[model samples]
Target: MSSTRVSGVVVTPVAFADPPLLNVVGVHQPYALRAIVQVQTDSGSVGLGETYADDAHLARLAAVADVLPGLDVYDLNGLRQRVSDVLRLDGSAQVGGMLAIQNPADVVLSPFEVALLDIQGRELGRPVADLLGGAVRTEVPFSAYLFYKWAAHPDREPDAWGAALDPDAIVTQARRMVEEYGFTAIKLKGGVFAPDEEIEAVKALAAAFPGHKLRIDPNGAWTPATSVRVAKELAGVIEYLEDPTPGIEGMAQVAGETDIPLATNMCVIAFDHLKPAVLADAVQVVLSDHHYWGGLQRSRLLAGICETFGLGLSMHSNSHLGISLAAMTHLAAATPNLTYACDTHYPWKTEDLIKPGALDFFDGSIRLPTNPGLGVELDEDALGRLHEQYLACGIRSRDDTSYMQTVQPDFTRNTSRW
Candidate 1:
């Protein structure tokens, strides 16, 4: 193992323009926040990482930086303990809320872990995938992530992606994406409307693109009974029903009654969640995300546990840019049990911090980077501009429900509304 020690670490919070996409939670804000982490080694090599950029997360990352210097990049467990110590000292250990299920320390450790791996890969002259047990495939497939949205935010100028609320409008949105990205699978963000209306949307998609793998995730907004009803309605047409209801018991109840495979990013969110989820048979498939699952290595561990239990494995995503996409592609390419196409929000993003022409999709798949340490370079100019936006943008945290209430005064969160 290479023995290069980390010399310094820099974390920058940035904001990028996001389309007003709608999901079970609510509409996405105009701009989304993400923090870019750069870990510098004594050899003058810098490894990059990306994660959520809210105020709390940013504070946790700063604490991670304080404990990184003089640490060996190969000692990941030591890094984890240091991060935990910092969070405990700062009284930020209990940063869990409705949005994320893991403790704040675990969540914050993900980006630093990725960065350390990047540094190790660079020193050893290997690709990130090679560091993660080598590549099992050259290209990783991705699904078209469909969402409900207005032409624009309440009073803002319209985005390039026009309004897509009803069945016809959603079909048009899928066609546009398919024409450009060649995605063979589709995953719609559901629970925006009633279950019946959302069922029509899925039926319309099936008719529009026959034999395509289709999915709908309502983010656990439905009751078990309603979830079962929707699953029965779409039976053979839908590949899987994602997070239709909340909690492990609720998901298991729906899974018991339906033939459709139940997948979740909501219920089985962390490592501790695996035992109960597997024991209860709550989910057939677990959608893995490196940002929240500790990091790429831990995500690989997640794949192993799922495989041992005879469960399916897929990937999850958030509103992000090329760096995160590059990391996801590397990790996905290295994992053997990831049978389903991963989810990505790349199409909806118009701006990127990475150098132009470095990352692109072909046939709905991103090719694994062969260059050392992720093989993607950041655009300093773009990063600076986005950082400026982050400073000027008043929004520090993501609250889709609050943003939605600006248009609908009677909006309230009802997990079993359907």
Candidate 2:
């Protein structure tokens, strides 16, 4: 058994300098990615995890620190239960507590979860997936995200980014993902680029790879009206429209108006988030990101709701490396109702991941872990190198990244981190 008592947590930030370039929501900015939360314990055994997007994740981490000084490392269930009870007692909301530890909204949670699970696996001498519920399929299919733009007005910034992306770049990237890396499905960025131009691009790419499945995610950049119009235009060409509307109500309206399947990348948060939409039969597909929900369990909860509502399940891929992608692949493999292709785009991050046997993207599908507890060991050397790179870059801002050092959440003011 390991001898570490959890002491401190560290946040590492990474850059998406080589992000998939495309117009999104009218703006163009390199998609920024934050790394995992490194949990340092007394025994010198470090446990890594990801935090949720808000102060809640920080707060949750801080809360964990409060309880970590003496908590036994091997008792993960006890540790989780303690943290959960504290969250419930504090009335900080169910989503943020566990989710905070696993899916920090700002960073993809899979890396952090993998880190923790890796530590656990090492401690128990097993693979991460074994900790959850033995693996079902060691391989899972992936849909690479062709383009990304994350800004208030994302669709308007392609020219500002300077170099115009050649249409051939899309073909080459798609070809590499398929021919070189073996991806079966590809998701191109849409909704933010000029409507006509975007439609043309989708058409060209769809025709380019007739055998591969094609999907488009606007990232909630289009209005319901535009979504319906675009869906009609892309009908018989595109597979589904993701987050075509900014809101669930809009989705319902679009669902009523169109025959094409309306999927969602956003707007599906938790079980509660799915209720009204599911009841309305607005969503045909559900794309739940662990980064948004926090961990697999919460993601499972969201999936449970999707299954109950008879909605399709697919996960969103943040700009993550191998460790997180492998964890996500396992979750996808385990899920029963995951029919539509999943957005697991870690292959775009790089060829070599920081973990071993975490994922093997072969012929358009990634193999899930047959080992126990998230099933990938972190390459400490690689992690350290990446961490140092982040420190050298200014993007590692933990304090000044937000408008407020500590924004007062409008709800009941908890004296915690957020």
Candidate 3:
């Protein structure tokens, strides 16, 4: 009956593609594929975890395999502490900090802990939400990210226009996403696309999706002054502006200058990261992506802290695939102050990465899966196919910085990927 019996950890490459049936923007991406980590116990229950960064991350995880391979499987808390130990030793310091001696990498530990959490949930015979505490709600509302470039013709570069996006196209997609995909809330990609363009796009979207929540992500593409001007300009048009300024102080400036909620997603990765942003009252939404701030358990802890502060919590998605999506859904289900809808990345994709029905959206909402563990089964065949594709293309390097430069949307230099 013990869940702790150790089996082994297997990490593999997966080039997760969106369901081909759905196309956004114009790029039918095999977007950025992530490495999937599976932790299987002697009991035959397998837990899933994914590393979203590039291939170099796999090397980072390799450093800690020896430390984890034979550890007791049932002790989730101990596994968490072990991961912390690795991060302390191998993690990056900050802002281009050097890797410390024997410092186990933080990126590696993230997926490691995720796999362990998956295993823990299986052993406990409950969803990860139950393992965290309990569920606050079974279903979570969704907010769609409308990346203009993805829907535009390949020749139409929105970033080059310094902020101009196609008005007619914006209106068309807004209507389609809401009506076809059941998206109740939407976040328009702003900044690098011109300021006027961003404003116009929002105006068009607002007109189309009224009563539906709307927010703008400049990706920190504007100066504090520009952010203020724009936030006020779109006053009644948008619900909030995410990372308007380049950093935390800029967010405070924007928040102070306007009534629209200023969401700080890029500034905080953990509770400690919240200090500067919260002290400045720079944002209303505390957006934390599990990949950045460790994993699910830690993210939930941060959400609780936000609750105490009367701050909003929206889990930021890194345009990730199934496993991460499932994990986030569980966290959202458990959190108490989850008011705003977080971005749901799966339904927007062109392909089914995992089971066909891991998470389903109905009329703009996704229910926390009631199934055991993360409630979705993994598709080994699809994962393998994508993995081989990446390998064949010789694009499996862990160097995501290079990959990003090639594919990232045209957000101004000020845009931040939190």
Candidate 3, which ten residues in sequence have the lowest lDDT sum? Answer: 94-103
The best-first sequence of candidates by lDDT reads: 1, 3, 2
- What TM-score do all the candidates reach, one by one? 0.97, 0.76, 0.85
Candidate 1: residue 230 lDDT (0-100): 93
- lDDT of candidate 3 over 1-418, digit per residue (tens): 3436656777876654432111111232334567788887777878888865354566556556646766776565776666666555533432111111133344456677777777777767788889878998888888877665443223443222122238777676667677766888898766545678778878888777778888887667677888878877898887778877666777787788798887866666545557777788877888776776667777777877888787887867655677888888888888778778987665455554587776777777778887878887888887778778667655453332333345655512334322
Which ranges of candidate 2 are over 4 A from the true structure? 1-16, 23-31, 39-47, 51-63, 72-116, 148-168, 350-358, 396-418
lDDT of 2 by residue, 338-399 (tens): 76678865654543325655566677787666555555556767766665655554543222
Query: Better model by TM-score, 1 or 2?
Result: 1
List of clashing residue pairs for candidate 1: none
Return the number of clashes found in candidate 2.
Answer: 41
The best-first sequence of candidates by TM-score reads 1, 3, 2
* Cα distance off (Å), candidate 1, residue 234: 0.3
lDDT of 1 by residue, 1-418 (tens): 4578889999999999888988876788888988999999898888899999888788879988988999988999999889878877433332212455547676788989988888787777788999999999998999999999989977789999899999999999999999999999999999899999999999999999997899999988899999999998999999999999999999999989998999998888888898998888899999999988888888999999999999999999899988899899999999999989999999999888998665688898888888788878889899999999999988888877788888887887655678
Ten contiguous residues with the weakest lDDT in model 2: 409-418
Q: Please report, as a residue range, the 10-residue window in candidate 1 with the lowest summed lDDT.
A: 89-98
What is the C-alpha local distance difference test score of candidate 3?
Answer: 0.67
Which parts of model 3 are misplaced by more than 4 Å?
1-3, 17-30, 87-106, 150-165, 397-418
